[model samples]
Target: MKPPIAPYAFIAPALLLLLAFGVLPVVVALLVSVTDLDLAGLADWANVGFVGLENYRELLADHGFWQALANTGIYAVFGVPAVVVASLAVALLLNRSENRFFRALRAFYFVPAVTAIVAVSLVWGYLYNTRFGLLNHLLSLVGLPPAQWLGDSVLVKFSVALVAVWRGTGLNIIIFLAALKGIPREYLEAAALDGASELRKITSIVLPLLRFAILFVTVTTVIAWLQLFDEPYVLTKGGPLGRSTSISLFLYQEGFAAGRFGYAGAGTLVLFLVIAGATLVQMRARRFDADH
Candidate 1:
């Protein structure tokens, strides 16, 4: 039997886009990573010299790289779970009602995700301002001193991650809501008839059924956090003694700021591997849990 031509025709454009934007960049980065390609190399290909794994070796020893890696890990550790739980909770609440008000509320919640990152960061920047800010004004009402949200090294990680988490949850809430809608109403009715509490129904039935959605959200959330960039870039500028400098930011600094493209490419490849490994581990754990 011949396969339908219509499906392939529909997918052809997307496949071409992925190959050009996604696959091609990775391949070029891989090639660049093996050479000592700097700003000069960009203008003259003859200046490029292959350095083998030297770039990787230097990256491994660089304290800045390690700090950036650690910062990214911290962001993921705090941001991923927060986004998942907050989005799921919001979805569960919103899913309870389908009225006009609730429908409008869903759109309101998703505003952060669609808004420009610069605009969101600017709003948050004011909120995090040390003085003459809404947050500080609120604290002054209680006779408390103003806290340095983005200025303190220790507090900067959470400050930056919080913005990302707030921005990230909007989309995930929609995903969870979609998954929640797919769940059969019969299961809830049966549980209700059996004298199960709302909490009981959710824990034993709703959550169990939402495992696939939960897994999908978790893996993607982890990947997003690992590549943390925009919020930190715009908010703190990876400042306060580089405490908020994520791996992605570090690569940006090296590649463009310092004109060390090859070194940055090596770091890019490492970051890619870390993302791939983390995703695989999550998926395998989910599979294992399902089997058990």
Candidate 2:
């Protein structure tokens, strides 16, 4: 009994830190979401009376918040799946032929993931500049009109999405490559014996086995997209008539920039719930397939 108690005691410190740092902040934020707290009232703890979800009500009525929500949805819907497919294709290519050049190629894909996002955004902004940009220069060579990549309201969101796809596709490729390698060679040989083509074997064997990895990639990518901030914040600044503003950017502006702390908290909470629910649905679908 004493030995068992000692092991439990050893785990207590880390658990306490997790509770303090992770759990407590979430609870406090939930409480803050129900109030009318602003920067001027920050020091007045006693005045922070519960307003019983008026912040949530206000968010529902706010057109700016709704616009942000729509932009975020569009980003997630288009951007995440495009990244997933591109990454999977790259991973499939790299997982084959263990040549030194291919090994180097694997590393090359991940360089963007480890690079500073602000620096990457700055370089991309220059490339997206209407007049002197590399993208426009190439298009000019082909006699196409120089289109405003980041400046036009209609094209800004798609431009931001393209940047996101470039940066995000690498991580998912690495994950899918690892999963592909984990697949046993015996299955490939067996499929070949049955006169199965590469495409048929991949469809029948490889994909079924890689389901979990695919599910994981999809869920995590969706979660990241839901919390999209840095790229849009740095590149577009929610500009071109607020066409590229995501929910997270909107929340940041409301909470910190405008000092509408409670309303921002409410927006944050709504985002949390949306991500949580979406993840749960994906997990449940996976569970159902496993059961079947």
Candidate 3:
């Protein structure tokens, strides 16, 4: 009796929390996705009605949905690679030096990751301002035109991606550094004995060992960028004709601003599906890469 009761007592709190928070919300959202839960519904629960997949069908026909999806894809395609490369490079550079200054730099780089998103977004917004911004000021010093980093269609996504990359690189750097530390010194020594150059040793030894870290970072980055909201929301409100509007922002506006809760729920479900599918593909690709 003590053994059985003790096991249940120990796991009961965790199970309760998981059911109350995780399982409950997912079930509620799934139900909401199939119904017409709107501002009216919020005011009076009786106002809600089952709409089935109407919201999803509406999403299929919505031009804004496709546009947001395309924008997110573009961001992930470019930003993920940039982040992976930058993180790996920085980790490699830092791995060579265990000095106190370099240790401090690691902490400094990771500061953005732990910082509040809204605070970071506000700072980046000021930096991206059209006039009297630090970025424009630097451009002036170089005799370059003061480009609208967040206002222009072509630059808005890139600017948002830059902020995300800045925030994310630190995390990936830590991950890559750990991966780097695990590499056997004998591998490097053997490569050196075989007359391998620095680049060759990295390509042949370091990268192969870091593949798991790379895959993990890339997958996580893709998922995060797909649901991007805060940076663009604070900076431009998905503005300049919605060029910076991501799926997350679209869903946010649909639910909160437009009171289209059902529509937003459908969008949320779609985004989840997309993330799930992408993760599966990435896992498969990584396994294939490892095999060969």
Candidate 4:
């Protein structure tokens, strides 16, 4: 008991930091969400009053908020699967190759993951310009019509999703590669001896064994999709008739741009709850799978 208490003493500092940096801010934000606090309210305390659920009600009714939610959902629907499959495919290919040169390939795939998103977005913005973009120029070489990539409302959301997939796939590739390498060689050998094809082995053995990693990836991708802001902000500015606006972008517009602090806080809280619920569902599914 004394030794256990000594271990807890070492953990105390990290726990304290979490409370100060994480817990305290969340509590303060929750309190702020219930009050009608704006910039004026910050300067003059009497202007702030308890507005209760009004903020939440207005947020739910707001068309911009709903559009943002729909856009985020669209992003997650397409982006997550594309990233997951692309990453898994890259990892599989890397895992099978036996050359030192292939190790360099891993670095190439991971480079975008570590690169600054702002810088990448700016560069990609130029690449997506309607008239003189590298992509459109290349398309012209193939006798294909140039697409108004970032300027068309119909294509903006999908275009943004493509960018998200391009940027996020690298991290997922690394994760899946790690998981693939962790898989026991004995399983592969045994399956081979049983005359199972590579595809069959992957379908029956590899995928099932990699279920936990899949769950983790899914949960993280969903959360990241919901909080999408940076790419759309830098590239599209939620433009092309606001087709690319995400929930986080909407929250930023309300809180910082529009100065509707309390309403933005409420929206943030709602988004928080949505993410929390998604995480909970993932945990429950994982638990159920483990039990089975």
Candidate 5:
């Protein structure tokens, strides 16, 4: 009895912290979403009135809300695959050589993973400048016309996606590098002895073994892209006709910037549901694959 009680006591502090930080905030947000909380409400508690799903309904009808949701989907759909593929490619390239230079190169490649988004945005902001940017200057050197990287509607979407891919792939690349290293030499040697080509071995053996890492990168990249706030906020400010406005940015604009706290909470809940649904679907798919 003493032993069991002591084990529970040891974990109680962690449980209390979780309740205070995680559970409490979410519960409070849920309550706020159903009420007409705003700047006025912040001034006077009596000003806050229960609206009960009215905010949610308003969000469903708002065109800006829908467009932001769609824009977020564009990032998740486009950026996640690009990040996964590029990370895997770079990981595979660097995996071939275990030399000191390549090891240093791998370390360099991971710089963007830990770098602050604010810093990346500042650097890329200059890189995407219309007339004087390095990227456009190089394009002009090749006789191609310089294009607006962040101002044009269509290009801005892909520009931000490219920035996301650039900044987001470093961590996944390391994950894939580790995954590739973990593959047994015996399997590749066995394939070589059987006269299997490099491509065949990769397609048949390497990829199958790296499935978990691929799924992990895919799921997490998608989730991160869905929450794309910092990049667009810093670079485009979700501008050029608001073509690049993301759900998270939209929430920020509504809640903190606009002082529509209830409206913001509703949008927050919507994004939360989207993320939760994606996670559940991925879990189900993974379980199904495992079962099969």
Candidate 6:
């Protein structure tokens, strides 16, 4: 039997693009990670000397790196569940109606996902402003003290993660809505005949049927939160004593700002491993639940 040439030809362009953009960069970064690559090395390849595991060792010892890792963890922990639950909830609400107004509301919910992060940050910046922002102004009207949303160290992580959660929920809501639509209407109709309440039908039948969708959304949301960067970068710049600095932002600062390409490459590799490991764990857990 011969392999199908047509199938390979069909996928070849996509495969080539992935190799060039995705796989090639990681390979180059891995190679660069073992060398003392910096600004000087960029100008002259001869300046890049082999320094096996040196950057990794330094990264392991660096307090800033550890703090960034912790901050990234915090962001993921806060954002992932919030995004998943909010997206799922919104999707369920949207799924309830096929009305034109509900359809319009679906698009409205998705606007944040398609909007540019820079623009979203600018709008959120005004909302977080202490002196004249709407949020603080509203607080004053309610006889509550105004909060320093982005300036307070403890509040900054949640503040940054909240923006990301808001932006993130939009796409996941669409994903969940699609999944919700795929569910057979007959199942719910039958459940209603059996005297099942809406909540009961959702808890018993709908939820189990939607397990695969939930897992998909959860895994992707987790990966996205793990790579948290944009919201914090635009809003906080990882300020308030680096409280909002994610590992990605930390790597950006190291690689671009400080001109430590090799060091940042090591961090990048570690982040890749973390994301892969987390994904694998989630997959395995889902499989285990499916089997038993």
By TM-score, who's the top model here? 6
Query: Candidate 4 has which clashing residue pairs, if any?
Result: none
Alpha carbon lDDT of residue 121, candidate 1?
80
Per-residue CA lDDT of candidate 6, range 1-292, in tens?
Answer: 9987999999999999999998998898899899999998899998789999999999999999999999999998888999999998999999999999999999999999999999999899999999999989999999999999999999999989889989999989999888888999999999999999999999998889889999999999999988988988999889988888999999999999999999999999999999999999999999999899
Task: Return the clash pairs for model 2, or none.
Answer: none
The alpha-carbon deviation from the true structure for residue 218 of candidate 1, after best TM-score superposition, in angstroms, is 0.7
Report how far off residue 289 is in candidate 5 (Å). Answer: 2.0
Clashing pairs in 6: none
| RMSD for each of the candidates | 1.2, 2.1, 2.6, 1.9, 2.1, 1.0
In model 1, how large is the Cα lDDT of residue 62?
97
**Worst 10 contiguous positions by lDDT, candidate 2:** 1-10
Predicted model with the maximum lDDT:
1
RMSD of 3: 2.6
- Cα miss at 139, model 2 (Å)? 1.8
Q: Model 1: per-residue lDDT, tens digit, 167-241?
A: 999999999999999999999999999999999999999999999999999999999999989988998878988
Tell me the deviation in Å of residue 286 in model 6.
0.7
Q: Which ten residues in a row have the lowest lDDT in candidate 6?
A: 236-245
Mind giving the per-residue lDDT tens digits that candidate 5 earns over 99-177?
9999998999999989998899888988999989999999999999999999999899999988889988899989999
**Sequence-dependent TM-score of model 6:** 0.98
Per-prediction TM-score, please?
0.97, 0.93, 0.91, 0.93, 0.92, 0.98
lDDT scores of the candidates, listed in order: 0.95, 0.91, 0.89, 0.87, 0.91, 0.93
Model 4 agreement with the true structure over 45-144: per-residue lDDT tens digits: 9889999988988888899999998888888888888888898888888888868889999899998888898889878888898789999999999999
> CA lDDT of 87 in candidate 3?
91
